[model samples]
Target chain A: MLDHPTRIGRLALVGLGLIGSSIARGARANDLVDTIVAIDRDPAVLERVRTLGLADHVTDDLAAGVAEADLVILCVPVGAVGPVTAALAGALKPGAILSDVGSVKGAVMAAAAPHVPDHAAFVPAHPVAGTEQSGPDAGFATLFQGRWCILTPPEGTPPEAVARVRGFWEGLGSVVETMTAAHHDLVLAITSHVPHLIAYNIVGTAADLETVTQSEVIKFSAGGFRDFTRIAASDPTMWRDVFLNNKEAVLEVLGRFNEDLAALARAIRWDDGDALHALFTRTRAIRRGIVAMGQETAEPDFGRRGAKG
Target chain B: MLDHPTRIGRLALVGLGLIGSSIARGARANDLVDTIVAIDRDPAVLERVRTLGLADHVTDDLAAGVAEADLVILCVPVGAVGPVTAALAGALKPGAILSDVGSVKGAVMAAAAPHVPDHAAFVPAHPVAGTEQSGPDAGFATLFQGRWCILTPPEGTPPEAVARVRGFWEGLGSVVETMTAAHHDLVLAITSHVPHLIAYNIVGTAADLETVTQSEVIKFSAGGFRDFTRIAASDPTMWRDVFLNNKEAVLEVLGRFNEDLAALARAIRWDDGDALHALFTRTRAIRRGIVAMGQETAEPDFGRRGAKG
Candidate 1:
């Protein structure tokens, strides 16, 4: 076995939410970071972090939290990335690497780039992993295991800094991929953002229906709506920021989705069973590919039955 | 324990897909039926059912299979309910209660009603439970445990038949509810049909994207797309029939969904984070209600992580 040295010294995390705390936990569990400093605007969150012992130090002060850190990651909502970076950029150590875990990369890059000092490299990354749950306690050390984390470093950034950021995420059990911020945003819009939007939209539609009572919808959700509700139940502030920041990509993908959905509705209206069957069959192949590639669980119903039984 | 008599003397299932095979397994495991006869249009399904020992008697002849059955369930797709009933209704035993497990109750009720013999009663039921898997091999004895089974017996049907059918489902561990077939279709249109359509649509859209490669979409699916893929991978013929049969209600609900989605799109375009946040927040409560009502798994990620680990 090869000796794995600590990749980050005095790692400072801004916002001890799900992503931030998971990074802290994963880094500590894997010995990837020498020291973890958890920073959040909420005092209660800082208190919870201390109680959970998730970090070596917990603070509400941005500058004090990040001072002298080898790596600083902003794990706040995409909308907050700009403000947080602006507030804390001046305090980043000369050689420290600045990164983030926002879902939308292009907006995050645009928001955070100007604030980042010339001495520090800004690497925007989106870890394509998370549960619908939020808060400090919702994170686990193994959350990033077997998941994809895309790093979108701006043009002309040092290769060593990009490589180091890649090493940090890989050390925490993530498979890192490098891509441009614009491409990352477009890819994520179809893969994550639009999916989440439709989920939220469907859940809202079901809830507001006058003919179907909420009680009936709740009782009968096991049919399919329950699955949508799981993702729709995700952190609202985070998702809201995601949609706002990734507006162009999300809307572009959503336009294609609407057009496809219209065709499906037309098929159903015209009683074109073959068309619906063809589409459904094609979709099944995509799922099989996802499962075969090990991105999704192979167990039926996500092995949800085992949890109950 | 109370002495529980067999609810069904001889059960004849018209299709040996996921629902049919599950009924056989649940019935046999709970001693709800003394004998089971599985009939399918496909000989392979019959052979598999026999190999699995899912039923005492397996055959492809619909009339021969229902010779002396006390209860005959048509577990075929919604589109086949009419033809299957027309083929088997003449053979139903006098005093036998007939039921079906189609998702669209109104269409099933209409299609099967005129063909029912004077001495036999028809009850259309929608079991609001299933995995995406299909076929006889994909079933388990506990599939219906603690799940909702809605019974829609046509008006003026004998009360005893409805009671006996309810008892049969309850014996198989389902919580039974009785409603009008029309209302059941309308409710399920929003709860199941439209949700399925959108899931299928989004998956198809993602698959057809020009800019984003399918590999990237599959790799980054954990962000939320994987959940949609699970349901989108369901039996194509079954779902295609569901949308075709429940066309009006599905179209009606889908219109409202489009309207709500348009509003959400407007909010995103205008960067109305508050509106997006409010909707996302409201949707979370619905998920809580689903979990509280025991209709969904409360464990995070549907316990998929545990399965992987």
Candidate 2:
């Protein structure tokens, strides 16, 4: 925003859910784009998007939406990336920059590149911002503020196109960074994917316990398990799709996490308090680092929308 | 406080640390006691007790403080229950009621009851409330509000004594529940101890993952590890004492948790999405149950005492 013009001649959102709607809000609020178009298969969703004024035009036809747009951002789940790309390929304008907001970069590129127009540039992005909530109604214009948006541009993607996509995100108040697709996958595997899986796994584990009742698990979650439940409560469909699409990355990180956790279990089983205490002490520094990084705002409530009460 | 009595004559806190000072604050706020006599070897902590307006007198002599007190509450770490009880046994007043706020009840009662005077009543209590903070400065009067205080009085412990302890807690706005020490230990092993240990374990693992890098872990902690770090940042001395005192119970729950987690890890390794989704979906219902039961406030936070920025 400090450097680029706040005007997008044409914009196309290939999916109209939370991320897409959030982007729509950001673009509109910053005057970053004009004559925006949105596409989703669900007529009801399209109707809601039109009513919400996330885009000037709403359509089920992906091709029609991308035909005259300067940018087409795929906001669907990772698994849908391929099909959406194929559907919108021929209609994408010459020199158009195709981007996405999927959580996994390698998977997104793998799914979308073959379908990308030969003359168009493709920039794959994963913005490190979201709430447990979903749907167009849940989005707000400032959702991306102070959050990281990593762009993974495959080799040979033109710099100009990358700059345009980066500029668009910058206008939305995000700090944009570039990373190789492989590195991005690794970083996210540790930061986002592993954490989500751990949360999901722990909650699942608690649910399966016979001695400790579910009601009890719920009742005293303040001890710590409650945090996992909140993350595990995230939209299942999105997560299901994420795991399926980022299988290699998620599984890879999960393997390391399990190894790390099993070692910890061994320590606790052996009553290795020194090891436990030492590890815990080191982790305290990480929390300080997170507070320093603008990625997480540590106002308690763990950066969720609001306080529990 | 619907059934609570009018006042306390002489209230004695067996330790003047976080829980003790907090109890002192709550008692003072409710005008539950005429005088608060605090017993702590740490003169500095005891000296600051009345700064929080929770204590009227401070002494390093446990026996002297317990003398003339009708209500004596042990606020020492679980491991220290034995020595503290022995030191104060000869000094407790006739017909005095005794209780504790230890996380582990069975162990505390086992260690403390032998030293109890025949004319005095021993009621081991655990208020399911705390913050990561410690010492007198962290004491707050509202710490017990809307929280649970589980009183595990020994069989044949005077009913009148139990009622008085319950009344004291109720006056502080805590909902009092009665359970056997064994049941209390088992429930707490899962609800509080295991979860806290798991959090400490995961945080430790993240801290030691030199290959993954610390800055990366901290920056991306918004994903999940940040929550664990927060929990693990809790008082090291208190947690060390918990693990040492509640050894058997914590180990029992840890075994169950590991078995369940192993099953989940295998399922993830096998890419069994059905199993994962089924468990994930089941867990969400439990969270809803927590919210519905008011165990977890429906607000996004778990009722942590913090403001959202």
Candidate 3:
């Protein structure tokens, strides 16, 4: 923040959900912008944002929200990016930078870049952090602290605009990294999308079991199923749009996941204890690497017992 | 430990790994036992246990370790339970009670019940808690606090002996529950065994992906894959034996899980957003139920960032 190159005169945040509210709270807390405009399609959400005093202005009209904004960030579900961008294109200030907090960068770029104005710069970013909870009520200012915010700016993007966006995220307490949109989608397919699908699938599977009652599963979840439940409990609308928009990458990685899963099933069926042992041992090193890199906590049982409200 | 029953005169631990060492430490800290004997087949482990002052006596000889002990607990891998129990069957004191800490209940009962002398009692228990760690150095005195310890007593076991074993686990900071050995297998297969298998399979899948490098997966694991990695990194030999010995129940629950996953995949392919949303919402309730039951943490992100060492 000490070496920040520029400040946003007016920042417009569309879709006042968890990500958008956190951005508003962080900007206000740090005084990164002179004025904040919050917009959401749901009138109830706009009312809640106003009651929370999360922005200087709250509105349901998109054009009015972005009329004089120097920076506009769309925080809606991935499937809504095209329509939202098209609606704001006519009202967006010339030379203003437009960005989004979408999980799938390639899909967002493809859907939004066409609607962007010629004078304005469009940068797509994905912040790799969140809890299972969602909505404006679930947001906090420090959600992005010590987390990675990946920016996927398309070709011919202005360097100054990109740096401004990077500085904006850095001011909000995030480390920024730049990568091609295609690479971003591929990496996220492995790290986020497939993992989420598997979690949802497993939870659904456990629920449908005839031999075990659902109450029993909940009572004894500390064994391991509790972790999957946390991941599966994420916002459904956002995740559904993510899978639908990023179909190719998600399906491709899922295919690879299935092949590996089949091999493991075979190992268990044929009593290949050595293969299972070797694979399990190799995975321990990966967990150690994540802990050492500060990506995950080294605390036993995820420090669940010592958590504060 | 106040208002406890008769004190343990001599307690013998058959394996000096995480569970056994933890029992030794817990017993010594609470003054619940007079003499603690630590037994391990590996001389190095025995030497380490002795160096740590984790036991009153440490030895590699099975006969010498269990001599005149009032309580003996087998803490080895499920596959080794039968052999360890047979070896100590003749050495156990006439009135001593024998127990084990194995995930699979029915198999442990079958493997060790035949070796129990008429004068000695055999009980099988499973503590539904653990970190992604193992070995002597990984144990602590309070590992069982706020955790569920299930004791599966076979029919015709003496009621007085069952009460004594129940009191022992309660004294070590666990809430104890008793059920038939057959039912315990089904419950654990759903709660622990199948969950571990799925975690192991998914971690292997991520590791084997061609589109994403292993290092990239580790770097971005905070997205969701990191949670699965913690469960998959558990002791390999112990899990291998779990799936092998509890084959029938694990396979049964696994079949149900596969069917559910296939249905979910179909929903995604057909773009049934409602179905996906409904399932995701239902799973959220299960997670909430777990938090309410005090089995899991309600803290966001498992309170990983604020954990103490």
Candidate 4:
């Protein structure tokens, strides 16, 4: 028998896509949960979940799928959380914990908190882990290993309920952290949303340039542009929902980014090497900090062979 | 004995930095050159190069280093290329090929072209491969393996000299391609220069944010920001020169990028999910094209285990 703690009786995962399927796989791999009930609005997704044996019971009916589940995780896009949470609000059992794996915590809490019953716990989470791929087949059992899963529980959320959700994420091999919903949204805007927006915008810009053909861009992309494309290639629906739901914080960070870019452009145009060197030196320190903190690989050349595997 | 074509009787690398050291190591590994002479303005770097045995000989004299070399490769910062090229112009032997590994081709060609003796060939080349690390200790023999090495030879330059340089790069395990100086600049402006500027700008912006502490940004950077930091952490002197030398192309691409980003920001503000989704989907296809073209890896989760080694 595998040695593990905090075994969940039944876990209901809504939206059987990347995160949902990964959670299902992880839960099963560690025997973290006894029963996994998968739910998705798309019938084809339900079929795939059943085929993969990802869930003990796969169903289209949200209420029926989650009725017996002790832990219910909403894994839909950020924009869909409000409607989806409302749809299943009547079904969650008393004392059962409810949570989500959405990128924008504020919007998720706003949409789902209204429908969360007084008797049930609602904890919002954002797992800072993923690949460029999406959908049911794109998930694996160890996606969350050594990654962060941040929980943004509401002001009056019960401590015990928060612990349960944290325990569940830990069971799935994540380092758990807690913060406020608004702070989570703000922090993620800088770390994820703005970076993603910049990547998407740059890729679009590169494609539309008349001087350079798309073939050339694709051919020579190994020189840093390809890195942006990987982040830009993330799921359309998911990113769209994230930007729409977190517009406030995204706009704020983007405003700052444009200002900084303009200043750097001026520095370059005026040939101010000192300013450029100082900025580069500061940023290099940040990369070192990230690597030292174990959030990034210390390998050189992007771990060339490792990237191939 | 390793069999490699276009063997160099005497090879001189002008700058014992990352690219310079890597070339020395690669030439030694493949036995592509019989004698390697490494030169650098910094005495410490030359001492380190000598200590590492990366080159058969190390010297601070630019002229003495290249006088006996049949192949002289300038591996200095873009800003230093012109001055260094002029300094060594008299030292290159008749019919010897002079080349550089600078990121910007037009500026390099312009700076070094006027100084090239009629008897020698000046073929500008750029190997689109690197790690964020710098200096002699960070280089390895396999750095250029499977990487693209673009050559932009001036019009009417001897085809034999271009072919010889191409053969040498191939011996080091690089795929070589030839393009006009202007086209190379435009292509790289989109593929490299603009991306580096954006990464540097974003890291600077994140560092200045009062709402989010630097520690928080660094902690949560695994979400996406860390990737930009890697590129931003590249050599400051090299990139500063890249921007100054390639100012027009960089500004043009940066303008387009800003416009596209404004549109994206508007889409988010207006909640235009369709527009956002359409653009995101299109960019996704481009990434697939790059991966299919073998410029990128198809591995999942940033190839976590591979990053370790």
Candidate 5:
């Protein structure tokens, strides 16, 4: 923890969705801020902020939320970042640090970095955690606990501002890692974007199968399809925005995924048992690595209980 | 709960893997059997069957396991159905009921139905529940609890055998449904096989990533990759056997899946946000339907806790 009296002066959170509300709660829970202000286009969202007590002040005006704030966080969908940044550009305090909790870094940086105050810190960041549930009610104080929040600061950004931003997230129980924009987008495309696309695609296929029927897919899903549905059940608008925003990285990994799937399809068609065995065997090790890395809990209860719903 | 003696006169289990051992244990746990005879050509498996106490008698000899069995269950991998059936054709008792717990029904019937004794019942069954884990120790008596069991009995099979087998699975707490063999295969190929292939492919892509290191993939897996690994962590040999045995239905579903995925990839490449959004939106309803049907639980705890290794 830095001794600079914390990054607790003032905070501006744009948007009042799940991610935004979670950050507000998380920031307040850790006493990491002096004042929290949230902005959303919908007055209903402001009412939610009031009811949830997630912020000190709430307004439908994005610009009004940034006034007097020392830190401005964009928590809107990726597609909205550009327009929202433009709206708040003139309202941010001179010494404020600007960051985001967007899913894709390159797109988000492209959208918001240009409008950042030259004297201020433009530390583009992505807190890599969320649920399929949406709206203000879906968030909680501990949403980012033990999750990774990647900070993709542009070159020559003020180091002190970056450290303070890092401290803010760290106090809320996130493990912050610094990454280049390209690497962050590429990593997330494989880890999140592409996988989500595949899940959506498979669920789409199941939905379209005239012979199989939707009822059958639902009934027999415990075999494995249930897992895909769980992921595909995510908010459509948010996911579409992510895949669209991270096009290059998503397509690159998706190409690789296509090749592998085609090879597997070939193995199945040719009845190449050994090739199938080898690939399946190789993947088991990766699963072990994930379990070892503490990313996925080893207990079946978490997965099963999620699938059960 | 019947008044008559609950003991099965003699039972033959055709494999000693996950589901097979689970059935053995469930039967033993429920006093549902008088004698259990397990068969497998693999030496290690025979040792496992004995080690797990899955049988009153165990052997690498197929004939020995089937010779006096009043009920014969083909619980081997889908690919093994044909060979095992051929091996045990002459050994089955005259009136013994022949059933299977294969994942793919049409193929199971194609492989085992022709060899069945005319007087014996051939009930093709699939219990649509499993963890990615496999092997004797991986099984528990509760594996089938609250799961769906599908029976694709041949057209002329005796009603009594179906009822008996249904009673057995019902005792284990599965809800049983009936469908034609071909229909069952197609339904499962879409619901189980294709989704598994998609998960396996995405996980494979993550493993092969040169851009994002494996450690990074593991660390950030909760972003989405972790769920795919849960499905991909399924047993290799068993899955290899599944694809090989259920070739037709799997190929058909895979064909549809690839076409749908290609369409989505094209939409992403061309920045067709509407198309992506529309498809994603459509699939979300299916998820809601699954939730309504009690197939999957909703996302309750988005705040992930550490895996208890």
Candidate 6:
């Protein structure tokens, strides 16, 4: 009802998966947008979106979906951003803002920039939140509550467009931060991309071990491997695209990880308990910092004990 | 009132940390033991144990603590098992069942077997359960519910002793599995030791990154690094001992991990999205197995969203 630019007359969400569906639900719950137009190439996804009543209008046609939308947010995999943007860019209303929820900003910005029309703004975003689950059913209205949403607007982007996008994320209960697309990719490579790669790699290694039975790994996973499995179980297509797109930063960080792991392996082999203890002790402080910053739960085992039921 | 072999007249737990105190609480809660004698070299731990009423008797004297106990379980770190066992073996009651809850069974068996008297039985156990938090206050009665407890009784051990130890674990709500000490160490090296080592290694890697600010890592940890931090935050002394004692199996498994990771990295560098997708998809089956087997919670984000309140 307010005349502020933050309020959207029509918001178009491309792809009705977890992030896209959650954005639709959150926007409606927060009254940040008057109407939502849900679009997906997959007819099944569009049907599901209609059944769930996630948006005011649903369609498989990209151009129709974004026809009159004041804002369009691409919530598909990073690899799909370019093609989807190109297909719908001409249909976008003049002065509309184009944003996305992709994890890697630099690559997404590169892919999406050329397709964005001069009349529209492109603001790349990465919400640092998710469950291992995927699909529309996996998302909730509160998925982004108390989580960080990073925005990386390309150079010369209109400040008003970025503000409106930031305001939309803030309305969905996210703390917004701004940085360069390059810096965002670098930070996320260490914090997210490489971590996921290692988790997937280790789970694969455990699965392929000749001496250990699969049943044994599955049964005794609670020790620590199960934690890795949770992240490793994340959406495969999305993660593959993440690694494929953010190759440089992920490889750079992974190289450091391998170097550090080699030293730890050496220390263990040589019975350097003090070295192991020191590193182990130092790592606890980082966990404490994360918990203290409200980015993680202080509850033991992520409060899984009570959730066991 | 039950006269089962699992019932203990006096059970001595040699350390009052997370695992030890949890045993005390579980034993008392299920009425598996008549009395628990809590022993620790640290006065503060003994005081905390007493204040929490975790055991019937609390003392710093290892010898005095196990004087007439029918079952003596060494609950200290694996590195301290030898010294603690040697210090108390002579004071053990005749025909007592000597056992432990160490993570690495083979090393613990080698350390404690020589000191144990002929009249006693040495049963090494590794309960595949725990949280990151430690100390008496962090212990809970339901810690081992629906968890696995692996027992590695050395050859020529009395069947009655193994049965009693197995029965005791069952009373604590654990499903018991018996295997050779060597296999237990190998199984645990992959399932627990190396997972923890890499978790510690990656967390250290992130903390030491010159390019990324520590504040940034802490702020964006929800992306996946935080799960690693949970396991990396475990007891430093205990984890150090696990790595040192289980060196051979851990290094062997770690070598495999490094090799697998190299292949995964190559796939990423060369843009083999198909290979990355195949591995990522395969790992999700293991997670489903863990959850189906009741070793993990099926809830998303470990049900942390609801716990946030």
The best candidate in terms of TM-score: 6
Q: Which is the winner by lDDT between candidate 2 and candidate 4?
A: 4
> How well does each candidate superpose onto the true structure, as a TM-score?
0.98, 0.92, 0.95, 0.96, 0.94, 0.98
The candidate, 4 or 5, that scores higher on TM-score is: 4
Top candidate when judged by DockQ against the true structure:
1
- TM-score, candidate 5, first chain: 0.95
Evaluate fnat for each of the predicted models and list the values in order: 0.80, 0.37, 0.64, 0.70, 0.70, 0.78
What TM-score would candidate 6 get against the native? Answer: 0.98
Question: How do these models rank on DockQ, best leading?
Answer: 1, 6, 4, 5, 3, 2
Candidate 4: clashing pairs of residues: A306-B306
Tens-digit lDDT track of model 1 for B139-178: 9888999889999988899988899889888888889999
Report the C-alpha lDDT of model 6 over A1-309, residue by residue, as the tens digit: 357568999999998888999899888888899989998888888888888999999888899889899999999999999888999999988899999999998887888899999988888888888889988777788888888999999889999999999999998889999999889889999899998999999899999999999999999998999999989999999999999999999999999999999999999889999999999999999999988888888889988843242
| Interface RMSD, candidates in the order listed | 1.5, 3.4, 2.6, 2.2, 2.4, 1.5
Which CAPRI tier for candidate 6? medium
Which regions of candidate 3 fall more than 4 Å away from where they truly are?
A: A1-3, A306-309, B1-3, B306-309
Candidate number that wins on DockQ, 4 or 6: 6
lDDT of each: 0.90, 0.76, 0.84, 0.88, 0.82, 0.90
Q: Rank the candidates by TM-score, best first.
A: 6, 1, 4, 3, 5, 2
RMSD of 6: 1.2
After the best TM-score superposition of candidate 1, give how far the Cα of residue B143 lies from its true spot, in angstroms.
Answer: 0.7
* Tens digit of per-residue lDDT, candidate 5, span B1-309: 334333468889887778988898888887777889988777898898888778999988888779999888988788788778878888888888888888887777887788887767788889998878777777888888778999988787788888888888887778999998888888888888878877777888888878789889987887788888887888887788888878899989889888998999999889899999898888888878877776677655322456531
Better of 1 and 5 by DockQ: 1
Q: Which wins on TM-score, candidate 1 or candidate 2?
A: 1
Per-candidate DockQ versus the true complex?
0.76, 0.44, 0.58, 0.64, 0.61, 0.75
What TM-score number comes out for model 3? 0.95
